[model samples]
Target: MGERSDGDVVLAACDLVVAGIDGPGVSALAGVSLRRPWDEIQPLLGDALLELGLDHHEHNSNEGKALGLRLMARRTLAGELSARELAAWVHDRFGHGLPAAEELARLDDEYDILEYDDRATTDVDEQVMAEVRRITS
Candidate 1:
């Protein structure tokens, strides 16, 4: 493939996150700043993450949690959702408090300089990339 556009990088990073990869892994895979807030980025990383979560939930057999995730994902993509709204939903569902402040700080602190690897794209990456292309197109 040629050089990845910004949208491609954001989509790939979102896919990596949904595939059980975290900040560092996504940064390495996409060679970009995954630590930046989604709102700050052009493609909106948070929206992509939520969308992928919804897709994952739909394809898997998990029903209860998947339903909730799909709802939140839809709300997010519709631009009708907020972090506080998601936090409230999580709290209501799981009865657990959200550490918003700490998590925000952690997000900022998670940046790392990763060496690029041409062979980084696995079979799953290709599948996710195809899905991303279909969605974005």
Candidate 2:
């Protein structure tokens, strides 16, 4: 669900794999819902995959990448955040198994808004709102 494999794939193909995994739903935009914390999320994946009878190894990579990005984004935004930080946040979220440089490059290639500009001011709240709009709509 996190990895943008293409434009059309919204959720993971493995239905059983995500069964019981508390993730972001449509209500995420309303800011009234809670999602599985990373600490809770990381451990459950193994069991979920096992229960689903799927290859845990194949999916674990993207899970880790997505978790790392979420962590980084939370930390960066909690402090002085910028567009570069936002881009880095998105890169880490989507990068998955790709190299760091490659991940950043992919972000650059995919979206014009992720570009880091020194001229821009850092505003975590505003940037987050912008990001939410960008991703959701």
Candidate 3:
């Protein structure tokens, strides 16, 4: 996590769907321990932005709204890095469509956050996990 002089760094992964894949699209914030120095994670953020296969075309379907990575870095009192600063950085980097990530809540299972909000959340996750296991096995 990018610990800013601010506080605990929080990250929400961008929803990913392989462009032409008909089944088993992947989505979730797989847990990661980002204990690297800010200098390291900073540039890595750019690389992550580049890897999001989202389509931004106005004519694109609902997927066009998929966000790039939400970088959550806490700034220290030395004030070298702060969450407030990350807000502006996120906007400038990912465009206005992306949220500043200022209001995210913590969750124990957040790494498995589902993209779907409907009643099928459990079903979707189970199906995807099953598909993954089947392929990998």
Candidate 4:
């Protein structure tokens, strides 16, 4: 793929964001970092993390709790299951909380602009380069 203007920064910071946000890209970016030139990548990473965190808090807040209870009540009334069972089921199926749409939007923005060029550097290439350098020396 063609190089992206912000590819390095995105690649560098993706790992932290993924670990926090539980997104699909998490696995692809397991160990990225914002070292050196990638330091500028922190703003994007921080924005995403902060947004996701806030969304999680909101999703688990008092209002959210009430909504969940209400939903469980309706389910119980319909003879679906007991309140406790419903709660447990919801928790397991939908997670304890959710990220906000704004946070998700920010993530989308970052991902859209990200440059994925030169993502994989094989050890074979490293070995070859080293061997070539040794021969030249």
Candidate 5:
């Protein structure tokens, strides 16, 4: 739970490179632009959105469509690609196409409750997990 290094994150700009996307702090980053500051890579991120076929209006592109958003949702939730840092960026660019930072925070909060609630199963948490799976799937 220490602070991650710059290469620890699988950023939107680094979507082309899948080395460290398995989780937070998972990738050495090999050869990617993640080492650069976010401002320098913002344009690359915009290209990623376009490459995925996602627009400012829609979540999925026509090529694979559902797959990219699903990857984004699941990887973020798993702490791989990450969402917290890019929430504002994603919102400012993609709008409803991707989850905003607030939604990501809500999901994280619900996930934390699921981990420690001591219930056999909370219906709400199950629903949230289901949503996570649905989006990821």
Candidate 6:
């Protein structure tokens, strides 16, 4: 793969965070309440970036890109994009050839299951649930 844009790296990092939270088995966000604090989540983001081969030395040296990624993550956590939307973004950017795209597809399935379970118990907004259903179904 060519060099990923800063924005692409940040979005991938966001995907990693969501996947870590919602993937099967135990997770840090598993028993948490509705509001997930960034402090608790930021480390996971850093780990995700590292796993994707982002160099810590480069990240530390490039303060601007690092700050941009942080802002992007904040926006992601703030619900600027829904799970489906994020998946689509990754799909469009990376296509099916990349490992990250495949992993994102798997994560999309996990997201669907979690959303289904959440919708079963709580009164999740109909529009949001419907969109998720439409995308996942």
Q: After superposition, how far is residue 47 of candidate 4 from its true place, in Å?
A: 18
lDDT of 2 at 51: 46
After superposition, the stretches of candidate 6 with alpha carbons farther than 4 Å from their true spots are 1-74, 107-137
- Model 6 lDDT per residue over 67-118, tens place: 3333433444467865455555545544454442454444544545765564
Question: Model 4, range 1-137, lDDT digits (tens) per residue?
Answer: 01133445455446456456545333233344435434443334444445445322242465554444444445555667643344334444344443312222233333333455432333322332332233223
lDDT of each: 0.42, 0.43, 0.32, 0.40, 0.43, 0.43
- TM-scores of the candidates in the order shown: 0.24, 0.29, 0.19, 0.22, 0.29, 0.26
User: Candidate 5 on 19-117: residue-level lDDT in tens?
Assistant: 433332222232345556433433343444454565532324433333444555676578664443323233443445434223534544444465677
For candidate 4, the lDDT comes to 0.40
TM-score-sorted candidate list, best first: 5, 2, 6, 1, 4, 3
lDDT tens digits, residue span 20-119, model 2 = 4433331121122124233333344444445445444435465555444544555444564554655655655455444433444344334454345433
Locate the minimum summed-lDDT window of 10 residues in model 4.
100-109
Please give the distance, in angstroms, between residue 48's alpha carbon in candidate 6 and its true position after superposition: 26
After superposing candidate 3, which stretches have Cα over 4 Å from the reference? 1-71, 74-80, 99-137
Q: How well is each residue in 56-131 modelled by candidate 1, as lDDT tens digits?
A: 2232234535454445545544557543444334445434322322322222222211123333324323433332
Off by over 4 Å in 4: 1-57, 83-137
RMSD of each: 20.3, 13.3, 18.1, 26.0, 10.6, 16.8
- Candidate 4's TM-score reads 0.22
After superposing candidate 1, which stretches have Cα over 4 Å from the reference?
Answer: 1-62, 96-137
List residue ranges in candidate 2 displaced over 4 A: 1-60, 89-129, 132-137
Error of 6 at 130 (Å): 20
Candidate 5's displacement at residue 31, Å, is 9.1
